[model samples]
Target: MNEFSDKLLQWFDHSGRHDLPWQQQQTPYRVWVSEIMLQQTQVKTVIPYYQRFMERFPDLATLAQAEQEDVLAHWSGLGYYARGRNLHKAAQIIQQQHHGVFPTEFDEVVALPGIGRSTAGAILSMALKQRFVILDGNVKRVLSRFLAVAGWPGNKRIENHLWQVAEDFTPHERFDDYTQAIMDLGATLCTRSKPNCQACPVQANCMAFKLNRVKEFPFSKPKKVKPIKQAKLLMLINNQQQVWLEQRPQKGIWGGLWSLPQFETDEALVAALNPSVKTHSEAVSSLVKWKAFRHTFSHYHLDIEPVKLVQEAPADWQGQWHTFTQAESLGLPAPVKLLLSQLESEYVKNG
Candidate 1:
């Protein structure tokens, strides 16, 4: 083992986490699911979601057979809906192509949907006890600080150099422990902000720490103002206390999830509601406008204006009317869920 691995392993034995939900009764399938959920999400936030997901779809066979809607329902609040969709698709592919077994070969595993090189390496190392290098976000931060890598890791050249560093640090024995160790070190001690550098195991060798510029090593991505967009969300409630929801198109933001019908402007929303009338002035006047809110995504900000109309949806519209309880079970977006809770509370208070 190298000096880096030696110190990291020693630190891991004493301080690393051992009892995460996915760590118990460990399998390739469980590890795969946990890894996917942990991407861009913190460990604490993922625990409950991981446990609930494991409970619902316990095995590869079960996940493979489950419907897309059901898979998305389990992933409702987890913002990146594409990950859930890709995971379900990967499971099905594994079932059909690999005879329901998680592939052991690196090439085969990486070929599966959403399984990038780093993710595949992680699965092989952590789950299968193979000696493969992992350069996940945590590892990138750790190594960038260790060597004081100059550019943003998103740049291909910088990423390639980090991958080389990661490969060099990986040891031949106890690959699983090392993989978890490095990630734990990064997650717990060498965090993005206000890192506990004094307690770091490799503090002696960390070039960034030595230079007193730990945070400066891993350079931030170039900034650009996220464009703001506007939408009018229609909460069309019928007399039966059911809200109208439509499934978003299979590709794009909130893909394949059921959400409130959205239009670009109030006039367009009113026109859709009053298709038979030449002018929607009367309908627009009767609409109840709720407090607007902003939901920001990674690339854009969506300023949503919610307009509640207690009119039955036209039979020609392509959507479903579901009661509050039923809508809760479907794959609704976070903002939609918030609006729904408010609507439910209002109904209870007034009734």
Candidate 2:
């Protein structure tokens, strides 16, 4: 092993995390699920979710056989719904194409949906003890600071350079431990903000640390103004306290989840309810507009105006009516869950 690997391993022998849930069993399916869930999410937040998911779908065959709604329900409140959708799709593909076995070949693993180059490498190295290089966000941050890589890691050229650097640092033996060690170092010591440079094993060799510019190395992405969009969410309720819900189209935000009916404007919402009322004016006057809130996405901010309509839904309505308890069991977006909880609390306090 080189100096980098040697020191990192030495530090990892005592300080690295050894008891992560995924680290215990060390199966390809477990590692793949953990890797996918870890993307853009923190370790602490992922632990309970990971444990719950594993308990529900313990093996490749089990996950492959699960329904999309079931898979998505288990993934509720874990933002980035596309990850859950892609994971389910990939499992079904593996069941049919690979006969319910996790592929060992790098090409086949990376070809799976939501399994990018770094994720594939991580799964292979950690679970299969293969000598594959990983360039995940944590690895990228560590390498960027160590080598003082100049550009944002998102840039194609910068990413290629980091990949080459990662390839060079990968040790021939103890590939699994080495992979975990490097990731631990980044997650624990070399964090995005307020990095603990003193405890770092390779601090002496880190160019950014030596130059007192550690935070400057992994440059931030170019900023662009996120556009704000507006929507009116209609929470139509019946005398029985059942709320109307519809499944979102399977290709957009909150895809495949049950959600309140949304309209671009109040007029559009009124029009939808007009058929049940004597006049459009009567429907508009009946809407009780509650507090509006903002839910921000990566590319835009959605300003939501929740309007309550406490009338029985028309029999011809496209969606079904469900009590709050039933809705909680279905896959729901974070905001929808919050609104349901609020409504439940209000009903309890008032009654």
- For each candidate in turn, the TM-score is 0.98, 0.97
Model 1, runs deviating above 4 Å? none
- List model 1 lDDT by residue over 226-344, tens digit each: 99999999998988899999999989999999999999988899878778788887777888999999999999999999999888888789999999999989998999999999998
lDDT of 2 by residue, 101-128 (tens): 8999999999999999999999999998
Model 1 sits at a Cα RMSD from the real structure of 1.0
Best by lDDT: 1
- Cα error, candidate 2, residue 59 (Å): 0.8
The TM-score obtained by model 2 is 0.97
Overall lDDT per candidate, in order of appearance: 0.92, 0.91
* True lDDT of residue 346, candidate 1: 89
Residue 298 lDDT, candidate 2, scale 0-100: 90
Top TM-score model: 1
